[model samples]
Target: MAAPFLYSAWVAASMVLVPFAALTETRKLRRAGVSVARAHEKLGHATEPRPSAGPLVWFHAASVGESLSVLALIGRMGQALPQAHFLITSGTATSARLVASRLPPRTVHQFAPFDAPGPLNRFLNHWRPDAAIFVESEIWPQMLRRTHARGAKMALLNARLSARSIAGWQKRPKLARYLFEVFDLILTQNDQMAEAMVAMHAPPDRVARGINLKSMSDPLPVDEDALFEARAALSHRPVWIASSTHEGEEQTVLAAHHRLLKTHPDLHLILAPRHPERGDAVMRLIDTAGLSATRRTRGEHPGAQVYLADTMGELGTWYALGDIVFLGGSLRPIGGHNPFEVAQSGAIALSGPHVTNFDETYDAMVEAGAARIVKDSQDLAATVDSLLNDTDARDTARAAARSFTESQTDQLDTIAERLIKALELAP
Candidate 1:
């Protein structure tokens, strides 16, 4: 039987509940340090000047990772369609900060408006984007409906659908069809995702198999002075990064580091928690491990056994310094953060077994000899030990990673070309 609370009912309820929802979300944003003056942007009022008299394409991403994944795509699309201006919108303060710092010329970043009818209408009317591209799985019902009504061509780029989400949408078949069919094109990260979208009744012709855009992301920028200082402080010690670690995963990383230290006493760890705000708690974990540490957010250099990289936007710097990268989130049930980002950094990437989130990407890398998987802390330490001692094997893994990542660049060009055709066909 279909779910009792169908999409129509949810839409009706949303039409009435939007005000309370907006207020609650606005409060959270304020607490997260979003500027009060510019908060109106989230309410569908523009604080920045809109680009005029061109084929303006609007790209929407949920947060920092998604926002950054599209940077290279936007740059490619900008070059391919020189007449087009780009508007990038994300829903977080951190994403806004990153976008502002990294966005290309002639591109604008705005906090995405809430999916309420009022704000979305206000946003659409003011900007009147010719085409809209949404990153990953952000299929906001009201936003999708409003954008479709406004005659903007739409595409779901690097689309992913988990088994749970597919099951939920299957409960509302018509609603699923309505949402999926609205997009002029749907580009998926893998054949598995493409097949899932087809099962949800997304048009087969419109669904194109493609790679994860995160694989094609521009290398994270590094602060040269910071890298220099980090090198000087470490003085050529062996290093590895626990990149994008979550709550329970930090303890695992700490345990692995503790074990690795006993064998390779000069080994260093850069623990970058997934959420920088968790820095304090992570520091406490490090202390419990009886390890000396430095917190990067406090402006300390990495001269200790563990460096807690509690700051944001510096993954590239650490990646450049690390000999191996063990991606976090996989250690816990949070799936996994992007390993391609690690591979793109030219580091030998390793992860735990629970990486269902990027299953295809990870499987491909492992098959290509670009990544390795560890089942537990002992395995992690053992693998890291082997990699560190075997210089030739380590170089082979890093080279394989770079080669696989570079080979996928042409996929971006294919996506950009298809997107341009979609834009031309827009009403």
Candidate 2:
């Protein structure tokens, strides 16, 4: 089918803005100290060479969560197609950093090109990917149309769209259908999303419900040396983690910790904010709460009532020290972080009710006794206190968490096989 007029208009607009977008993105990367050549990747300049042989499968995601969610799937696919090469692209420095450490074997990471004809053409021509998989809601109209035109098989994985987004697409049915038809398959995060995609005019035959890719992510890498050091510093004090805490939510968590301290005097709280750059601000909050705290980046021990784990890439180690974890983001209508990591670490997840992002995963966990929902500080404190004091209950919850995580892994194989078949990726 020919490109719709709206699609053509979008491409024309993007083409006109290409130079400005490239200059802006490159400058941002340079300000962050990225090398000139690497920073120019936004202009479709690749820092790495394409694989010489074997089918190259490309995966593109928007940012950190979306980027990391597909690593395990790549690993599974790698095992199935040992001779295949994989490439993943995202637009954030943080995602690039994290992905660098956990990249699957035979996989390469790249900064995605700006979505315009010039950049897209350079990217697609250089990589020459046999298949493309787009994660979450990263729908670049030009990228989709261009890649599909090149005859690469495409699938939209872990797809999701908000009600408002669906309504917007419904308004432009021709362009929506044209874009959605570029994908050979559309695997949504749930049936509701599948229905929404179809309502937005994605072919019903191509859309199906799939597992939440975030929930099936590879377990966070644990630093054993740091884990040992933290364990020694704590001397087995009763501990709980409040990880990925956002701005407004910390007050509630601090209040909960204060209440818990009255009962368990030696209890420790590991507070890891979502943005580690907010370390100083978080410390001020801790001081105002009248709680003595130690900072992780300062190399201080967890001897104080609160351990400010204000660093990136150490969450697995913190989760190892506790059986109870209060996942943040949920407490303040921020959609919540992944609880699969908590489950992988053999801990029960606790959160406030606002976990719409991972609603299906949380619902299953709550049903299986692997997770709990708290309303506020009182509820959080009471839940933590009970779990800490009741060994049998904590043990059951931990076991349930492990069981839930294990159960999710089986579906990974199914999803991988489906993608392989749909994308014709088998060697």
Compare the candidates by TM-score and give the number of the best one.
Answer: 2
What TM-score against the true fold does each predicted structure earn? 0.95, 0.98
Clashing pairs in 2: none
lDDT, model 2: 0.93
Candidate 1 wrong stretches, greater than 4 Å: 1-11, 425-427
At residue 52, what lDDT does model 2 achieve?
95
Clashes of each: 0, 0
**Distance (Å) between predicted and true CA of 153, model 1?**
1.2
lDDT for position 218 in model 2:
92
lDDT of each: 0.87, 0.93
lDDT of 1 by residue, 1-427 (tens): 1323455676677778878877877787788788785677887888877776678899999998899999999999888777778999998888988888899867999889887778888999899888999999999987887798889999999998778999888777778887887799999988889999998888888998877887788888989999999999999799999989888888888888899988899999999998999999999999998999998988899989999999889898999998699999898788887888888888988999989778888988999889999988889999999998999999999999999888888888888888888767322
- Candidate of highest lDDT: 2
Q: On residues 1-427, what C-alpha lDDT tens digit does candidate 2 reach at each position?
A: 7789988988889988998888898888777667888777787888899999899999999999999999999999999999899999999888888999999999999999998989999898899999999998999999999999999999999998777888999999999989999999999999889999999999999999998999999989889999888899889699999999999888899999999999999999999999998999999999999999999899887889999999888898899898899999987778998988899999999999999899999999999999999999999999999998899999999999999999998899999999999999886
